[model samples]
Target: MQSLMRVVRSASALWPFYLAVVLFSSVVAGLGMAAPFIIREATDTIVDTVSYGTPAPTRTIVFLALALFAAEAASAVFSNVSGYLGDVMVARIRQILSTRYYAKLLALPQRYFDNQITGTIIARLDRSIANVTQFIQSFANSFLPMLLQVAAVLAVTTYYYWPLTILLLLLFPLYTWLTALTSRRWQKLERRKNAEIDAANGRFAEVIGQVKVTKSYVAEVRELDSFGTHYGETVALTRPQSRWWHSMDSVRGTAMTAIFLGIYLILFLRTLHGHLTIGEMVMLLQMVTMTRQPVHMMSWIVDSAQRAVAGSRDYFRVMDETVEPTANRELVAAIETTGAPELTVIQHSPLDAREPVIGFEHVTFEYSPGEPVLRDVTFRAREGEKIALVGESGGGKSTVVNLLLGLYPVEQGRLTVCGRDVADLGVEDLRASTGVVFQDSTLFSGTIRDNIAYGKPDATDEEIIEVAQRANAHDFILKFKDGYDTVIGERGVRLSGGQRQRIAVARAMLKDAPILVLDEATSALDTKAERAVQAGLDELMKNRTTIMIAHRLSTIADVDTIITLRDGRIDEVGSPAELASSGGIYSELLRLTASSSAADRARLKAFGFRVRDDEAKDS
Candidate 1:
């Protein structure tokens, strides 16, 4: 009900159209009632003339028939106009809702998405829009017009048959009672069916997304059985719901027909007794039929309202979500007060544009209260320095990158980039100053050119070619007959792991931000692919403040500094050689790598690490 009211309030802009539809419907209804009156007059005129031993004139009968036709013709035209206007009003409301809903979805915080299934979210949104539309349409085309018709019929009937008007008033309560009872049960069925469908869709989408994993684990038969179970549950719920809906419709339809017949029988008996004329009986029958329509529509209108209310609650829940602080005036003002350069641009500046490009000063954060993900994490990287963060899986490696990107809020202390506090920087400004390549590279469904141009929408062809060349993606891009124009399937499924990583590097290169975050960038690839991608990474890292988060220590062997994290705290930070020689956390990790294989030992030796030959031999 609250959702329905919200939808109505949102559609207040179309009040003028509503007014016009109401007026048109009233006019149509009035004209429609005129037909019965014309028939009443024609019948009386013919009967009176013939009963008095005089023949009824052909012209009089023809004139009455033409009058009835004119009334019907006017009614039809106005009804169509009313219907057209009502449709326009509904469409305008839908357009308004769609725009606001989509904007809300985009502005919502990442956590909202993380906690929801993509398919279920989509289905809920679709149903919300449909519910609002159905309710508005039902009210306009069915309920409101039916009310007007009822009022018009009562006004006319009360003048000639006052007792009949009283009876109609009394019967309304009985009809309302019946509709209420049926609608309650029907609404329950509808709500259950909706939940079943959403659950089924969410499960189905989850399964489809993990199809590769299922195949790898040889769980195809299990997955098929799971899907079948979900389908069966949905079918089981839907069958009963549908049966209830049809049964309620049948009850309403049967009651209405029986009531109308009873009313007709009473009127027929009245005419036979000479208490009512043949013409009056015809007029009364027409009014009863008009009244019956609204009475019959009551059940359907209430049912639609119930469905709408159920879906709307979930929809508005999303619209009311709290969004991340994309840009805050107070935060910006605080940063400006520090006398640092204002971070106004939403794109990367040249290499000499800023210094102390990325830093964390005793910063702390957590996803849940009382559970810190990072604590006292202080680090800084000057312009053109390549800093690497290496740690176990649960360590605060990814958390650091997330903070730098402002995906999560900084709860304590400060993080700075380009001499401005990152906590105070607008998300757009902070991200524009940095480019990121994640472990799982995600490419949208679009052409290769489109994906590359995503970060730099207006990038020129020459600029794209230059970056692609730097990232080592140009050759493979050319191998495709469509070249840059080649269409990549969802997440670039058409491209190999190496090709996708290179394209991601090219995308980052195109952004050309002063700060680069490479999070497990090449950790998933084979040696050959990693070598190819690393070469591109080298080109991209030049003259930029690079932050590399990797599990593979070999990847960051030559970085200017290495930071080792342990239990959400920085355990060691120094030049790669200095940390490896100190026999600290970094040294122990290096020893573990040194013992993995002779190849690792040789790689450590190549990186100038002092790995004893015995360490390699023992393992």
Candidate 2:
């Protein structure tokens, strides 16, 4: 009923198969419930013939045997068909649950995805699915069939021997109430036990995933000790929960066995008193035999049902979540505004009137409630403008780029892309207009051609190759075992960092968006790769609004304008040459670097002084 609704709803889509299943169950129940009557008939007929040594009873027994065989065959067919349908239903539920989970995973906020543990997600997917699967296959297949059979047995017993039926009715309620009371505690304990198991699973997953790092740092003993400590806690928590569940089961079973003994005694006494015939006694005995299995099985199934019901509730919670980035459909005003006091500007080129590319109208944003990440930042990147954001480690450069990509919303100012505020443009439209190349080489497992074409799924072979060539990656790609068709391992792990970054650039080149965001794109590359990628970058930036977030100041010496940022505020913005000439923050950073380099050279010079001359060896 809970999270399992999705699986049920999905399974419901195959109602024809399930309806047949229900009908089959009904037939099986009918056959099973009638088996006792047939047994009783056979027993009484044999006993009557034996009492007088009567002849000519063979034909009657044959007819009864034939009827029983027919019922057995029909019931077997019903059972087989029901089983097939059960499998089909389970498969469908698994598929739907898996599909919806994947969709939900993608829809969750990026920040949320980054924070949640990988192991925890995996455990939820595995355990929740098992819960839904058990409910579908076990509950529907076993529980429903047993319930129908129980009803049939009760009816037949009550019709023939009303006294035993009356006894059963009285005793059944007593056990049911007791079982129900104990079951509540069992269910509560089950929830606690499952949570503890998942937590332990998460801890184990973390250790295994980072085992390489743990060993490299020589922290294996520490990790092992931590694991043992947490495992002990998990065991401690689980023991009580397990004890509670097992205690309930034990109590229910003892009470049920006592009740069954009483019923057997009453039936045997009634037979001796002649109040019940031999046939009725046999029938009642057979009914008891048939019903014992279900009663025992029901106790275990009840625990499963409680777990499934809870699991189903949790699964639906995720499916029903609307984490997609969309709000009211109202259009935001697009007027530009002035910057705050901390936002300094000098010799900054405004957005070209003809192009009207990207404009920041005093954008003020904060990752936290009080700490502003980007404070009233204002800038306009015109077409073909290669604007560089240079700042200290915590400066909000990356945040600004994320804002342009519409990954986050601007809190106090409007950001316009091609004259429409980013909020007004919609996420899909904004993404369509931008291509990003980040410092990390985000490559997928695929052939060179496949990876390149990911930027535009429908790109042709020639087109894909052309984009790779443009990004200076085509030559290296040709050296693979199968060239463009070669399968790169997952995340292109087999490739060098530089090669991966070049592939990323090729992907962006294939996209060819009007705006490009290069967040230290060359940082991961070696000097040779950097040189190769620089030429490609120059061409890629041609006629596009470029926003580059750079850490190394020397690399962006010729950047169109260096915006010196400090603590979410812009300290200065000017040409690299101008800023150097001005002796401001940029000049100070350059001087500091120059002094450090001189000291390094001086140290090296002293170390080499005695080693540089052949006269030292001659002396």
**Deviating ranges (above 4 Å) for candidate 2:** 1-12, 166-215, 220-232, 327-355, 597-619
Q: Give the TM-score of candidate 1.
A: 0.87
Model 1 alpha-carbon miss at residue 32, Å: 2.7
Q: Which ten residues in a row have the lowest lDDT in candidate 2?
A: 331-340
At residue 246, what lDDT does model 1 achieve?
74
- Scanning candidate 1 in windows of ten residues, the lowest lDDT window is 334-343
Model 1 Cα shift for residue 319 (angstroms): 1.4
TM-score of 2: 0.86
Clash counts for all predictions:
0, 6
Q: Model 2, residue 13: what's the lDDT? A: 56
Provide the RMSD of all predictions against the true structure, rounded to 1 decimal: 6.3, 9.2
